[model samples]
Target chain A: MAASVRTIAVIGFDALQLYSITELIRRENDYVILDTLDEQCDIDSIDAFIITPSEFVSRFDLFLTKRTKTLILADKVSSVGMDMSVSVVAINSRLSEIEEAISVLLNSAECGAISNSELSARERDVLKEIASGKIIKEVADTLNISVNTVLTHRKNISAKLGIRSVSGLSVYALMNGIIK
Target chain B: MTLFNINSKLCDIIFYDSSVISVINRFGINLGVGDYTVAEICRSHNLDENFLIVIINTFLNEKYFPERLLKTYSITKIVNYLEKTNSYYEQFQLPNIERHFNLLIMKSNADDGNLHLLKRFFDEMKNELLFRINFDRQEWFPQLLQLGNTTLDEDIELDNIPESAHPIEDKLNDLKSFFIIHLKGKYDVNLCQAVVSSIIALEKDLKQNNRIRERILLPFERALTE
Candidate 1:
């Protein structure tokens, strides 16, 4: 199957830098340069953002709220005083470096988006009950929830953890101290 | 999406995608392919040229699934190819990944707790993979071989067998993402890259093999059983 094209929004670069980065990005058919990010821009559609450190800092709350993959284009990594989690690439990085950063950023963003979503309190309780070797009915009884609610929680847990198997979920729970 | 044809030169095809060398190896073809076309190689190996081309094309392009062409080949041949693929994974790919993973962990800082998690995940993935290999070897392939012989084994429960490769595929992808995105601390970049690359290679191979199993093998089995 053809890979789904990833939309990238370039923000806060000079015309020359923008042209260079756009050209670099255009080299890969898998990536399309979306329109520049503005107040009216639909941030939800963007898969990633390439922005200057200043630009990222200026709209830090927006980016953080969106939790979109953002790459900071700076002269040096240490110059950016943002969270260490945010990826910083040198402004003069090679095309390969830029591509690698975007690829890794997008990949991690996908898994992070699911994993970073903390399980709801009720989901955790259901998880704890289920991970302790309780069946769905038993889990529902123990948690004082309906069987359908327990099933919903199980589905959400699997979706969040990217683990479909009960044994895998049990292992994850044990590893994370959710269960003894 | 140019499909490799019977006239496609082996050397040229290798130059196009070096990964096809492994695919060719499964067909019992080796290096020193020197100037020979696909037909010539097939003739020398006593292999069906169409079968060879279809397999290569399937590997080369994910979208190229010639179901009719695949059915033209004998089921036994397909089973043999799949058996070789399982052996390749067990004997080469799994061990290869483990070696690189070990080196990566060794080169990494001792206090990096995430590496331990990664190792645990790898072990789990490895066990799952071996279980699949064994299942195919002991059950699936044998059952396929017994096709059209007496009544089908009622206990085989072919319909109930889940998509066995999918979880392994997901875990491999997760492993790659973890290595690239989540892994931190000082470690040998080269070793880490090696581990990631090996994982990617195995993932690609598994995907291609899955295409064969899903699109070709399963359909053929269903048609015959029905």
Candidate 2:
């Protein structure tokens, strides 16, 4: 499997606002802008969404409850229902503030306390190897398993943990002492 | 002049053009005291007076650096002074040149594909320099400083590039050739000239570092280990 870079989508931004925001985030190497709300977007792969209050209507279900982190503008924060986990920034926040919000949201998930009682011993071995920077073929070679088995184990791990990126998994391993 | 053989109080080095500061700044000797002359500043800092004269003349004429004269002064001292000049150049000049060069290539009638590739090459070169200098400041310089203060005393200066595991001369030549091969008729004349000046400045820095590594650091480290 390829390394995962988190995808962020900006919703409800006018053309001028979209350009400036995209320009700011463009400097960061870790992020990839999936698309603006102007066209059909890949909602399934989106790791996070940046939406204004008026535009939150387009992805109301996402705003309410989704495993993915959502960044809501300040003006729209008041209208959001209780019992939701979302980061809020000022209506006219600077680039630094947006960066802070994104970092906090990305790190907020407690992957350090991952529960893997369901994973088989072989799956656990594959997880540890991949998290330690081994590719699928290397993991298979190291464990004396077929490459197909390694791919199956990776898919199962992503499905179970809902964590996709290599960086994210690397952090999880470090935090949980799965890797040094 | 042995600090007193000539009249120093009324020298004309600083009185002509305000831009003369570019020449005078090479000494890293400042006029901190309101009533001091260039002689007094140089004497206090232990700088070579003859070398200062040559540097100032070169700066005034907009000529390339006098590479042969580098051997006459304390190489570490010259490296320290040139490193400061490099800082000032990066802060005040690099961005302006990059922006102007980019705008020129964008508006030119040259082959857009090759021009764009050249632009990317230029950007990569600039980024490599900026990142390398930053790493030196953040990691290598600090480590050297700690070693200097702890044991070497007057023997080690922060700008002293140590006897590295690699050759410094090859790196210097590589930097020079990168500029020569890329910066030419393809670029606007002013842009080419500005980039050449930048390359020369970078060369002076590496050359001084190489001198220090060979002259002072290698012997000093060998003695310490022995």
Candidate 3:
């Protein structure tokens, strides 16, 4: 099977460095480099965002939201202060290392996208109440939330946990010590 | 997705999607089906070729539910096929999954509590499935068989036969997701892969079985009673 082409955005590089990086990436058959990161650029469509360290620092929150798919281009001295959660590739590293970093980011992003099992605080509250044998109305009353909100949380919980049955949720709660 | 017809080579169909081997097995068709067309196999087995084709096509492609075609077949035939599928599950699929799961846990670290939770989840799922199978064998199938011939018992609630807030197939999917996402620590990758593949196969089988039951069998029974 042919490898799926990965869409990438090269951000925060000077004209000379950006040209060199884009040329190197273009030589490979499996990558499509976006022209520019402008307002019209669909951020989510890019599978991997290759950004310079200065740009990452300036827009830390934006990159943090997509940390799994973000690859930071940084020198060794500047990389020490970078968040360990995000992958870092040296600015002057060999082409192979940069390619490998992007590949790793894309792979991890795929796996991460497969399952988002973590429950939010409100979701945890709802789960605990529901798993304790409370019906939807009762859960809403306990949480001081509307019935529709409770239902929405229930749906989100099921989607995240990959479980829809109250009994299954109860078992998960008991096993995970979310509820006694 | 190829729509397999009566004249289609059974071997070619099998080669196209090997997973259909289990579907064929449920029909009492065994392997070494050398160079035989579907029609030829159906002739040898005294099977309905159209029914077999419908089942195979539905199994191969999720969107290919020929409801009109399915309703033409006798309920007895559909029920018998479903019973055979249930037997396949009880006799093979469930045990096979548990065996792989047991091996997976054994190969992992002894102190891992998450594995124990997963086993608990599996046990619950297994119980639910067995309960469903028993319900089918003891109550639902008999009622379905007696639909047009004899009146159903007044006390027997037909709607409750296959009812569950959480379907057994979804639990299998949950187990699969756990393996793929939440499972952490050192363990046997080969054994883990075996368990995941087995779960996925069973999940697919169950979903297909459900489509037949929900779309074909139940609606046919309802129409007959009406």
DockQ of each: 0.07, 0.01, 0.24
**Which pairs of residues collide in candidate 1?**
none
Once model 3 is optimally superposed onto the true structure by TM-score, how far is the C-alpha of residue B222 displaced, in angstroms? 2.3
Q: In model 1, how large is the Cα lDDT of residue B105?
A: 84
Q: DockQ of candidate 2? A: 0.01
Looking at model 3, the pairs that clash are none
* Clash numbers, per candidate: 0, 0, 0
True contacts kept of each: 0.00, 0.00, 0.32
Best by lDDT: 3
Q: Using lDDT, rank the candidates from best to worst.
A: 3, 1, 2
Off by over 4 Å in 3: A1-118, A171-177, B148-166
Please give the range of 10 consecutive residues that has the lowest summed lDDT in model 3 chain B.
Answer: B149-158
TM-score of 3: 0.66
**lDDT per residue as tens, model 1, A1-180:** 233567788888889988877876666445768647667877787777889989888989978887676778887666432542366778676665566555444544443445546665666787888878899999867765445446645755665665665655665666567887
Query: Which pairs clash (backbone N, Cα, C closer than 3 Å) in model 2?
Result: none
The best candidate in terms of DockQ? 3
Best by TM-score: 3
lDDT of each: 0.75, 0.53, 0.76
Classified by CAPRI criteria, candidate 3 counts as: acceptable
Interface RMSD, one decimal, each candidate: 3.8, 18.8, 2.1
Per-residue lDDT of A43-62 in model 3, one digit per residue for the tens? 77777677887887887887
